[model samples]
Target: MINDIGDLLTNLLFATKKIIPVAIKQSIKDTIYALISIPKTKIYVFRLNKIISDHKKVKGYIIYPPTLDWDYMFQRPQQLARQFAKNGYLFFFCNKSYKSRGFKEVEPNIVTCGADTRKSLSAINDVIVYISWAGHINFFRKLKYTKLIYDYLDSLKVADSKGKGLFKKHIRLVANADLVLVTSDILHKKLLLEGRIKKTILVPNACDFKHFNIKKTINKNFEDINLIVNKNKPIIGYSGAFAEWFDYSLIKYCIKKRPNYEFVLLGATIGSSFHRSILDFPNVNYLGEKRYKVLPYYISCFDVAILPFKINDITRSTSPVKIFEYMASGKPVISTNLPECKKYKIILVSRGKKDFVNNIDRGLGLSRNKNYILKTQMLAKRNTWDKRFNLISKYL
Candidate 1:
């Protein structure tokens, strides 16, 4: 009698001890499995659909750098890819670092592929967009596409030993590509001088105005902003990776020059000697990398934002996304005198260490310049991913 009572109670709770509908039992099993699983079994089912599902053939975009998802810092190629997906095109973003081998549909029209499927991309069709020239150039010939776009986002000169013959390879790739997009004026001029490709066009890096702008309301999710702002010191900020291109000596010089102001560096320390050593300084605050969604909140606390890049061949042709991001925050921006910075009226370009420090001081004073804010915000509004896609649609 005791065993029967215990079995009846257990069955009533689980709906498994007695006769029940197949769907109800299945739902209960699924609920139990979901509770125990890491990310839930349904997520795996959705990911598996990319490999087994019969997807319709449509216009496809295959981006080379593998960072196709929205998670990364939202670089130029990924931004454009998302825009294309929104406008009804199939997109495949390849990530060589991904542990899995198959492609998964992360969005409505966007599919992200892992390293296992790098060489097996026959499913996607149409546009092939190459962000750089260092990838396997020979394999490109095998892929059939209506258009091939080589977007020069970075200078290949700084690449490792594998990039030795890249100039010649780029010449060939440019010759083969239906359209060539250069991100900076320096790159545009260089391509023109080479005379290897005549169909090259300039499509500079742009801002996601909706995310980085000052007008956006801050909700409870932006708790980090409150913590940062509560510091109460005049904050001078830099957001992005601390790479070799970062001017460490200049940063150190500025820190010493402006001891009264708090200098904050936000982002990963990617093996840069200066970044590793600079934390020892008194006034410098090294806050590690923040997520992409919350970056605007952290940046909103900044009184003056900076782009202290070392001027070299690599940086000469660089079109930084941070300039627009900083501008969109409605904060004063002081940057190194890169060739591209000359085109923007809002940025205060510095010549050297003294100039950089002085400009930061000047920027702090001009934080409430409504005219300057309007100009930068207006410029940022015009230069967006939507506008860039409109230009790209011309060739497509």
Candidate 2:
């Protein structure tokens, strides 16, 4: 009897081990999120269906899968949704969890809500499911859609954070995608080497040319930056995430070599610990972050803009959107020799310490030249998000 009991206990333990999944932490979080979202489920489902019913005659629904919150960062996903709505497509932006009450029409035809609308998506036809993150494949696979798009924006080396099992998911996504859009030439070539993709296109990052080209009066939004830009020294500024790949050492070297210039840092930081290291320099001014609406004013204040990124696989694969915004703001850009930025003749790509300093000096002179400003703005006009979207629409 004792021997039989031990054997049964052993069998149960073995079965339990096989039943449990990998990514245990993420699984727990999902369970908690679903429990908390239960009350709002009907509300969101109704809101989602209401928008769908209103636009039943439109050219297919454009589904933005749960990736980032509608307000978080306001980058590519937000831009694409607005364009989709303007083109007469109903845009549904689903969030990871319920952070707010009810659904809101973020833009004219773009409605954003939480995950309660997920199951409802699987029932709808004529939907174009657009996803960026590889981890979303599991849920998105169940959606009823006429087309599926995977935007390969960054290398996997920098993408994972939640202890994700990404490799298999990425392969499945690429294999089954109706269209694979890459943001850089490197990423595009990567797909070509994979050899079995359906169709791939290179749709690089772009800017809101009109938004950044505004002539708004510099209000209190520029108060902090104004103090530095008003000084006799020319200001070198940057705006973007201060992530792990940011070359803080390169920025320190630049600050040390150019003591006469006022260096200003804008935007938010992520996984960055070199704040104390760089801010110690007296010439360097950390201006903190600003909203996307008022970001143009901050960019306008800079005499020259900089992209001081570490040369690595993650950055090499990136098509920096800030470069286009800086160009649109009519500011001369000084950057490290990022392959993507190298294509732009207007950018002053630096090689060594002396070269970087020299480029900054060159940019200061160029900033004042009317023709240089015009040319930079013209380049931005050619690479607007509108143009990038229309190109993708052709394939869609």
Candidate 3:
């Protein structure tokens, strides 16, 4: 009878702990939204480059669609808004359906203009840069701008299968724009071949030197992991989605063969039968999804990082953000040889599972020389978001 009462008490406490926090969080969010108000603004930048220095004092707004919530990619809408606000740019985000409902009288500068607000883009008489492929085309067709720029950040066709149609639309948008900014040389070549002779520039992805300079200070979260790491034991790490494109079979093979080493997967596991099979491996450790800020900590724990992507059209025209992040971690990277990743000598390219295993061993055996670290840092510095945005600014 005493044991039953104790179990009941534990269950009640657990229930209360889970339920109370959710209700409290929702209440706080509502109160915060109600208390804060914004004024109407003159100019608006609709895309994600919220780090513009020139537009610090300019009266501008940002529009982020609700569609971003569909995928679990690294999205920081609130962060973007805050960054813009810090730089004196009025920031706002609205649901896609909000504008159509005529609920425009929320805030002046940071109004939640829904779908109907998009139509206002044409009459605003301000510069509008469309960042994504489909959204850029849709905005271009409707909105008139003093100077229009299409920031082709990725090859949509290779990024997702659903983006194939938008990829063609992006190509057309490239031809129509005043300036086109691409993120990869391979993509630049593809666009040029398709006759995109407009003011096109290649601006690769970038990292925050201050944030990613691991050599300066050891991140506290990583300090615990560092205690366990020894030169005698090699650690292989991969940080990203365990999506359909990820070669789990190759990962399994590597883990099976290299039983002595540890294989750590640090990311969200997609809900798929194939992904579930990865759990069967006793040597593999899935650290689950981590916050963006916490990622560098985990990455620093890795001896060698890997990009195990399957070769296909989806991967062919791709420029992965993880590649830059891996290099920024100052770890030797072994990637499956893909056309897009071939230009970087800092990465050891492999053809298949055999080559991947061999290269992983080679990378693990190599010394973490200062030359390699400097070379990796130089490459990462060149391909940062600031540089990418600067190239886009020229076209805008």
Compose the digit string of candidate 1's lDDT tens values, residues 1-396: 234554555466575535777777667656555444534233444543454354455455555545333465557766877788887677767765666456677777777776665555643455566555545567566555566777777788656434566877777778888788889988898887888447777898888898899553546765645555667778899998777889988998998888888887888666544456788877787877898777887888888999999998889989988888888888888999998887886789999999999999889988878887778788888888889889887877
Off by over 4 Å in 3: 1-56, 59-72, 75-125, 140-144, 158-164, 215-232, 270-274
Per-residue lDDT of 160 in model 3: 57
For residues 230-257, write the lDDT of model 2, one tens digit per residue. Answer: 6868889999888888888888888988
lDDT (0 to 1) per candidate: 0.74, 0.81, 0.62
What TM-score would candidate 2 get against the native? 0.85
Q: What TM-score does prediction 1 earn? A: 0.81
Off by over 4 Å in 2: 1-43, 161-165, 272-274
What does the lDDT read for residue 95 in candidate 1? 63
Please provide TM-scores, in order, for all candidate models, with all chains considered together.
0.81, 0.85, 0.70
Local accuracy of candidate 3 as per-residue lDDT tens digits, 101-138 = 32232332343444544454444445444444445466
Top candidate (lDDT): 2
Model 2 lDDT, full chain set: 0.81
C-alpha lDDT of residue 266 in model 2: 84
